[model samples]
Target chain A: MVKAIDIPFGPQHPALEEPINFTFEVEEERVVDVKIRLGYIHRGIEKLAENRTYHQNVYLVERICGICSFAHTTCYTQAVEELLGVDIPERAKYIRTIFCEMERIQNHYLWLGFTAKAMGFETLFMYTWRDREAMLEVLEMISGKRVNYGMNTIGGVRRDITGKMVERMEERLNYLEERANYYKKVCTKERSILKRTVGVGMLEPSDALNLCAVGPTLRASGIPQDVRADEPYAAYGEIPFRVVTYDGCDVASRILVRIDEIIESVKMIRRALDGMPQGPIRVKVPKNVPKGEAVSLVEAPRGEDLHYLRSDGSDRPARLKVRAPTLANLPSLRKMLKGVNIADIPIVIAGIDPCLACMERVILVDTKSKKGQAWSGEELWRYANEWYRES
Target chain B: MAALNLNRIRRRLKGRVQEVFVQRERRIFIRVAEEDLRETVKTLIRLDGFNHLATITGVDIGPAIELIYHIIYKDAVVSLKVQVPKESPVLPTITDLIPGAVFYEREIQDLLGVKFEGNSSSSLFILPDGWPDGVHPLRKEWTLGRISKKVRRLW
Candidate 1:
């Protein structure tokens, strides 16, 4: 019998984009157990939001997650708007929906690239990222920023999507749709991707529901639970789109769900653009929100993003809570990591599209010797690649 | 549709809930005593079909800390609000019923100094290891100045 070893995989590792640590207990090749430690990148944003005024908190909340900035801002603004008892104009709602879908497309592409790179498919990574640039360019053109598009405000969006911008966005959307189809073909036909991802990191449907896995992860496990379809916030009530789901309950199904959702996002954006109503984008809201509390849910690219706000009849919020999708998906991630080979760690971690920062180092501790070895995330990536090649 | 769910939940949890506030179409907030949180959650999950626990939010409300377990039922957010006095900010763990709540509970424990009675893992979840004990940042007393002053000594 081989002795078990503890591999501390990140608060800073190459495979992890964020500073979250996962301690894996390994016996030979299989992982016996897992423990997760988070808050390495805790910015105290919720506490900060309490100090900032309701208007200023929009920008503060947007900084919570770089990729889902709009989702954060939207949720924040929606909660505050509810507190103020304001309904945004129909045009503003359409604009919010368009940006939400645009963000989803770019985010899924980013995840696809990173997951491909994690699986040692460098070419696919480069290609997906290249196609992702078109979506980013359109976002930059509309919001004047790539990642954190501060488009949302208390009553409505900050900027309006003009006719010229709409035309350019349409052109970009067509290109993205074509690229998405091609990538779908590649993801389905490629033998290496199939071998690497298929039947890997399974989270059963019951386990997923009990664990409260959200976004693509839950949908991939055969659950059709989606906030957009369920709650219909923003303009999702007016827009028609499918909540994509797959029953494979593995890494490959997650890949398929994301890819299919990107196509759905593309369709949603096109429809929003075509059917967008004309009206004032921004409305006047009171200086201070009343003494009320509200909860807002947005279907962020990764999963369900929830924000809660309470006012004390003051300029600032009494309290604010932001639950990013990554936090919701962490438990399911723990469930997925169990019983998998050590070599499959990177792919499984990348499969969730965790919204975090870069890693610097990793520590591997042998339980028997009580000795430790420090390694970089790149080292682990290389080790996984070599192990797969040898096997 | 949302009102129907609200009425069903109101009728089911009639005696348990202190106040049921329908903030909007799909948002329902129910205030319950600390002891009834587990049973209330059980009812929501088992009978009401509010299986998805979106998150748990804790706010330091002057004399008491407000703990809101935001559970998703269909399209609505049924937030179960329970307040525990600041002196003894302890509550039962819902992790047994919904295992995903362990992280959120630990987060509240770390930041607000709330204790989950039956939670197994007591070590810090979100805060850094060296973060000073009893310095719950989310509490109203731990203002920006106080936090910086307390956290600054560590460096």
Candidate 2:
């Protein structure tokens, strides 16, 4: 008896911070399949990035996602710099690293806030954002702006963090650590938190890698592959840190993975500040680049980010390819959704922290009945679902 | 320094490897002619551990269009670029071998106007409504009237 029940949710859901819609095909309250369609906020950022010069594209890419804006710009700039063969300064590396960690602090807390909101715990969501403000204030002190830092360039950073600023950051980190530890306990160990997350959306490691998964989603599945540690870029190879991984492969596992990384991020900032080498913040970058290709990978708050750049001495890139973590991890939705309760879909999807600007998909499924459709390797094989080939 | 799992397949019966690049610190790039792209993709993706299609990059050279299919397995990244004339850009889709390439292939088509043979939908992505026919913004010839002139403003 194969009964098909369908349900459509989103483009406007409390669980999603961006505009995204997903359909779940449920079999008696348990989701057997899902069709995720999210093209609601397709802003054409990639085409825009191509139109701008190498230097200007940094600012444009930063605006891709407000949560992890710095990481996007840094990855873009680093790739361009490599293509141009320009080396950044030592102090600038440390400063950039510090800012990246600051972005991480904000992104993780924002996820926690969204997680709280998804579970109907508005008070916890309010508290998480309240604590998040401290991180934002510190970021403003360093960058002189809140959202788009405008700190990164092709060769180096725009400014430096004075010793006084470092001391202030130290104080802020102390307070934040105390509050973050408390929130971790309340959110991960509390009775209600565990009931909502534990054992929900469990995924195995082999299944995750098969789906080309990344970020906390892959980490939660016990794969010790943090782009920072495995293929270190910037000052990550020089710094000391651990890749946080959990073997549980469930929603709870994702929460614990990000929470511990938040704690480690604090340590990275402190190390960068204390051991920062003195040097110029900016390097002189030539307008024309040599003809060559370079690839760069970095660990964003979500997962691994890949950039491929080739230059032909032109103002713009001859060949540019960017692989955001959100896109890489989308394939794992099927693995995570199988056998899970229909009500728990939001939590499982949120575990990956997807950035929708890079992902534009269609959301068309039965809006009610909550039944998921079976999507095998065949559905994906239909090919180029987005572009037309005129025969 | 680390190990990778890859199932390497040579070019099609009529195709040959145009370029083979082994990167120093990051990944590998495989360059094949346009005709053999289908065979190259099918063989590499079925490798015991190389089931994932990392990404697809489009390079506009003004005179000709280039498509680079990036494949990742374990820790190694390999790319295969197929160069096509700008006049009529079209290539077969590899979504059959690795389903993950669907979005990436779509993105290349949307940006470069290179059609993926046997794709599901044929539409523009990120192109403004009522755009001109046969105009791909990423192509080098799609000159920016005033946008390119802003090069001096960054200084």
Candidate 3:
């Protein structure tokens, strides 16, 4: 009988941040079964939201995952606004859409560079990261912060995009569009890169749906499902852009999907800027949200972010549930990892662009008692450090 | 189109459901007894083509645990909620209908004390190792300070 051995992958690694360990059961360098352990960064944000006021929870939710901070706050605030029955102004919707698309561009660029770096395409990684600075500069210009731009609140955005800001954004987007086109060519035609990515991590379209994958990971498999196109939050209802699906269903196709999406985001941002309605940016929302529950879904840069809010006629929420995209995409990652070479694990994972910090929760199962065990984050970190040192 | 399909499902499960209403535009909420939960979701899947399982959110109400299964049908999201008594928080698993529910089920079972009858990986998934037995942090009774103190004592 061929024996399968276990390879402990990570609570810490170079390909991504956030502590997630994958226990891969391998037979002759091929991964057969996978086990996952999480919770290295669990801050109990959902529990914390219950004690804080609605206004304070906005900033709290934004910190759930820095890469998708705006998406989290937008989703949370939209749910709160719905609970309060507050209607934000039209101009605020346009500005919100612009920021969302800009964040998408910045996020997609970061993923492209990271994936390329994983594949050892260092030059392309540097190029993508360098060009990515343009989008980050635009975000900072508008919101005055790079990562966690505290622009979103209950009724609308805290910042506005002026005509000069729009002009500067247009110039940068034009440049990004040009570079995106070039990256598209490089992704598709470059021989070495193609060899590493094409057909490396294959997830069938049906499997993607069955696994309930979200965002670009689902779109790359040719599902044509997007919350922005389907639900039409913010200015997406007025803006026109493609859903950007690729049927290749491989790591290479994921690259193509993200690059194409960058172009689409640029176009949508331009549309939102040019056709922006002139009006107030926010409306006055009541301090205490009415007793009600609201569900808000937004297409985050990574995937669809869902927020479920329940308020019991008080300033603080009764329960706040944030389902980040990576959480929805984790099962799909396990499915994609099956039957692949151990060497391909990094590229396969990088393709998902997992934000483990956003979805952190620890699981400790006592094998003898078959019961759950609680361990602190500090203890988990120490355990990981010891494991690393011993290995 | 979505509303009509939802209405048809609502009509089908008229007596089985506890309460059913459209929460807002493009969102629906269905509350069902614990026994009717899986069958209700299967009926919705068959009727409205609800193939996507958005998420399963578990909340601790005083005497029971509330499980909300957000299923996506076309453009609208339909939430199916089932409440199990806190003393024996056990419910049938719908992972057979939607394979993706397995992760969320495991998570709920971990954070809350709920048990799914047929879920395969209904083990600890999101909690840290050495967590105390019979202590659920997500429950209403478990205060933030209490959980921190418990963790500190363990450390």
Candidate 4:
């Protein structure tokens, strides 16, 4: 007889970077059902955005997720700029495109490292992160910051990619391309990696659509949809690149999709560098934005990052709504988690690159007692650890 | 083809909605009657190929709570807005059609006090546990001062 047991994975688990509590119902080695509890990191960024000026919210949104900080700022700034009806300069558009692709390189490397680390391939994790540092160095050279570039402003990019900076970025890109190719080979041919990820977490293309999966997660499931390709923004319309898709529709496919995307991002960045125009990077705009609602969508590393800003002819946004890719991809996570081994839970969750920081929001009330139970960080960690050992 | 798709969608829900128009480039806005919302959404998803429900954003617009369901179709985004009186904010859930909307609907229910009629899972997905009941933070009346005051009193 199979004895079913309830296992709480985390409010604070060793696997999760952010606090996402998952209570897994397991029978022997297979997961029967999974209940996810979020909100541990809910800072109410959307509500907070309503209180800050449009200019101030760029920095605020940039902090929503560390790995995709540049994506958030770009989306927010683009929405505000749309509201202002100011045309961004050609040079600025190319500069924004460069930063966006550079961000993709850094974010994909970070996810690759984290996923490898989750799967206990510590060597691969270290190597990927080491190469990731080279990408960050290039970002820091251009944006003056390693993490949140602060490159985006209302009208255009804040800084120009000087010729010297372009040369440095090119040097880094060549190194990154070589490393990416090596990683791709290891991902495709490595026996241990193939055994773990090949047929695991299989998601059909139709399932991906029903669950509204975005970015690489959706693309891996035999869908060629990408925001940059579908809806061209910045310099994407002018630049040349192909949307990468795989028919494998499994964890291995997801890994391969991102690896190929890194190659494509390198090509796009090189295109932006070669054809970059010369002009002022920014245009002066008024403090108060016109009364309108603007929707901006950018293909972030994980998925499509969307921002909806409603301005009431004031400096501050009347209402700001952020729909991060992770939120859209959570249902897909739940779908993938079902029937997987308890140990594979970490890689499956990390595969989605779940950014709970960006997905977190506000309000809770327990229906049974009319009062919710708040678990301390230490208590939740203990609960997660105890379940892992027992199950 | 994109224009025809939008036109077909607009045609299907033209009479059921209060107003509908292209808000901007690649954005179509439709303000629907509260009763006709679920039907309109079903038509869009089932018939119009608007498979992706990008997100459901709830805003406190003074008198009424406005819930906008941003649906993705190819390159365009169709935002279906439905307004409910703040006194009794309730709307039918679309989770049955688009499973991805469960989280967004729950978020609206938690933060804005807009009750999703058929959304089964009520355990708070967004806010931390022990938050005060009947006090929706996203409501306009629940200003920063009032919210802090309410939290202080609740504890």
Candidate 5:
């Protein structure tokens, strides 16, 4: 028998800028069961691909998200290029790699700032943004815009990073490294910061793997998976970097993992500069691509971003499907969120460093109790702390 | 990456486990050999460090519905596509094995009307109240109406 115990968390809440409604049944503020409902931002991007010309779809895919605009273009462009079987020029590869790293740095900085702001650490957020501005400036210099660089095209990238620009980026990144180190300490040593994050939201390695978590979220769970190091593309194969991993497998570990990755990306950019191959930035693509499917991926700041295209020997693709990392990662939240209080939901969710969208709501109900209310952050903390203390 | 021979990964896993293809030096496919998928996945996951299964891709591939696992062990990607016949498209869910594929499986089931065996529930992911039945817009057979049927975007 279903008694009335329905609770709505949000399609809009302070913890989220985007809308998602997670309604969970409370058993003394501990979420025993959860159901997630999300479709609020599904703009039918995949269907939108069916009508657009293959060349035009690159632009369409990039608009899927502002923060990850380049990721979309890169993955889409790579898929098309693969189908056409064209070799991207060495210099174009270098340039794409450079900008790709720039995107990673900027994204990590933004996520760092967001994580800080989510935790009420306004100063840390401000500091992170202050440091991030320099990277965005460099991105604007290369692509003529702060976000959505607009340089990706089928076969090759459209822009090149000049030596002078590389020097400029290096100078800024050096300073960013310094500031990132400072923030690293704040994230690790600060009681409030550590208290809110450290062990609060945890994903055991098994659950992380079971959920097929990606990017920093997976790496934080002691999984050393980084696409750049794994399936090197866009000059990634030519570059050198470590696959950053954290054994903590908690929100704090994720923070550390992202920080470590930003540092690595900075190094990758420098390596791209040191060994950038000079050549044409664009290459000829097939007027009519062969009827076949292609799948391509890139190490986006979030995680593995995938693009699949099935061309029909026409200018337009017969089918295109994009698998954003968050799609695989959402279920992993259950492993972290449950058995904890509600207040920690926002920041802990933030800790996954989620792409601005892809929030799902889980609904839970207790058969025995008719009363219902969703978990708040404070309640979440009390429950988590109580469990930890009691144990 | 050094260890990943995308060609070998593609060859080894092809037919035995799923639909396999190599594109621009990368290998990907869907897991069809349900019984061998875990072992195949374990090998890929161990070899190339394709440590993550990014997401699942589902398409209404005409006669049979397709579900692609899209695994990333290291940099090498091994996609597992399980084709289910339209009359009764049912593939065992790997969520218990790769928990990350849960939501993706859910999304695939919701949009394409393919049933994933072993999922605990199916309360509808993208559909809404009073949504008409047998009208999955993503199906190759279904075309988008001049005005889509009150489609609400999911965040």
Candidate 6:
């Protein structure tokens, strides 16, 4: 007889970088149902945005998520600029595009390393992290900061990419391209990676659409939806790039999608550098914005990051709403979690490339005992690694 | 392409909606009533291809709470806006139509006090577990100071 057991994984788990709770109902080895509770780290950023001026909110929104800081600031500034009825300079647009793609590269590299660690491939994790540092060095060189670039402003970018910076960035991109190709080969051919990721956490293409999955998660499931391709914000309209997609509809497919996206981002950055026009980096605007509202979308590393702004002819916004890509992808995560093994849970969660800070919260509950237990995410990670080793 | 989509949306939602206005290129706003919300969404999905519900933003006006359902069709964002009175603060849930709306609806319910009827889950989504009742932080009247004071009193 199969005994039904409720296993609570994380409000603090080793597998997750941030806190989130998932209570898994397991019938033997297979998961029967899963319940997610959030709000462990909700800081109320949306309510706070309405209280700050448009200029200050640029820095404020960047704090939403460290990995996708530029994505948030870019979306926020674009909405405010639209309300102000100002078109940023051409050079600034290209500069913004370069930074956006650079951010994608760094973010994908970080995720690649983190997922490798989750799967117990320590050597691969180390290799990816070493390669990722080069990308971060280039970012720090351009923006004077490693994590939150703070490159975006209301009118345009805060800084310019000089000829020297472009040359340095090109050298880094060439190096990153080689490392990306190496990872692509390993991800496709490595026996352990293939065994762990292939056919695991399967999400049907139809389910992915109906559940509203976005970014690489949607593309990996054979849909070619991307904000940059569809909406053509910033310099994307002028630059040429392909929307990467795969038919695997599994964890392996998600990995391939992000790796291919890194290659595409590198190429796009080079193209943006080549086609960059020489002009001012910013255009001045008045303090008070006009009475208007606008919605801006940015194709963040994870998915489509959206921002809605309503201005009431004041320096401060009437309302500000941010829909991080992770929030849109959570429903799909719930769909993916059903019917997977206990060992596969961590990788499946990591497969979404979730930025819980951008979204928020997690708690675990034991239904059998009718009580909640605190299990660190790291312990769950160790358990999965050990289970895979024993198997 | 966006213009064509806008015209089709305007024509399709002409009589059913209160008003339709284009904020700019690719940004379409339709002021809809609470009763017509489901029908309008169904028409957008089944007739036109606005299958993706980008997000729902709820704002607290003085007399009523305004809900904006930002739906994406191709390149354009066709927003369906609905207003419910503050006293009642209730509207039909669209979770049956789009399953992904469950989280967004719960978020609005927790922060703005606009109850989405039939949403199923009543758990606090983004707020702390022991948050005081009837205190919607997103409403304009609940300033930072008032919220802090209320929570301090509770503690």
A56-75 per-residue lDDT for model 6 (tens digits):
78877999998999999999
Scoring model 6 with DockQ, what do you get?
Answer: 0.70
Docking class of 5: medium
Candidate 2 per-residue C-alpha lDDT over B1-155 given as tens digits, one digit per residue, 9 for 90 to 100: 22442224332223366777776544777777788788777766655445356577788876778877766665566777789887778788876666667667776776688888876354554444444556665676655653234323433
lDDT over C-alpha atoms for residue B85 of model 2: 86
* TM-score of each model's chain B: 0.93, 0.78, 0.91, 0.89, 0.75, 0.91
Which residue segments of model 1 deviate by more than 4 Å?
A357-391, B1-4
Residue-by-residue lDDT tens digits, candidate 3, B44-148: 777655559999999988898999998887767888899999998999888888888778888888788898989846356888888888778889888999998
**Whole-model Cα lDDT of every candidate shown, in order:** 0.89, 0.75, 0.87, 0.85, 0.75, 0.88
Residue-level lDDT of model 1, residues A22-71, one tens digit each, is 89999999998999898888889889888877776776787887788889
Best by DockQ: 1
Whole-model lDDT, model 5: 0.75
TM-score of each predicted structure versus truth: 0.92, 0.82, 0.92, 0.92, 0.84, 0.92
> Which DockQ value does candidate 4 get?
0.65
- Give the C-alpha miss distance for residue A355 in model 2, angstroms: 2.4
- Here the TM-score of candidate 2's chain B is 0.78
lDDT string, candidate 4, A1-391, tens digits? 6899999888886366688888899999999888877788878788788887677687789889877988898898888888888889999999988888989999889889988988889999999999999999998887777887778888888887777887888889999999999999999999988888987877888889998999999999988888898789999999989999998988888899999989999999998889988888888888799999988899999999999889999888999999899988888988998999988888888888888774322234588889866767567557645753453
Q: Estimate how well candidate 3 is docked, as a DockQ score.
A: 0.67
Error (Å) of candidate 6 at residue B146 is 1.1
TM-score of 1: 0.92
Candidate 4 per-residue lDDT over residues B47-92, each given as its tens digit: 5446588898888888899888888877578888899998888888
lDDT of 5 by residue, A98-158 (tens): 7878888898999999888888899998989988999899888888777766789887887
Candidate 2 C-alpha lDDT tens digits along A28-74? 88988876654567665565666556765776687777777788888
Model 6 Cα shift for residue A292 (angstroms) = 1.0
Off by over 4 Å in 3: A358-391, B1-5, B120-123
- Enumerate the candidates' DockQ scores in order: 0.73, 0.23, 0.67, 0.65, 0.58, 0.70
**Order of candidate numbers by DockQ, starting with the best:** 1, 6, 3, 4, 5, 2
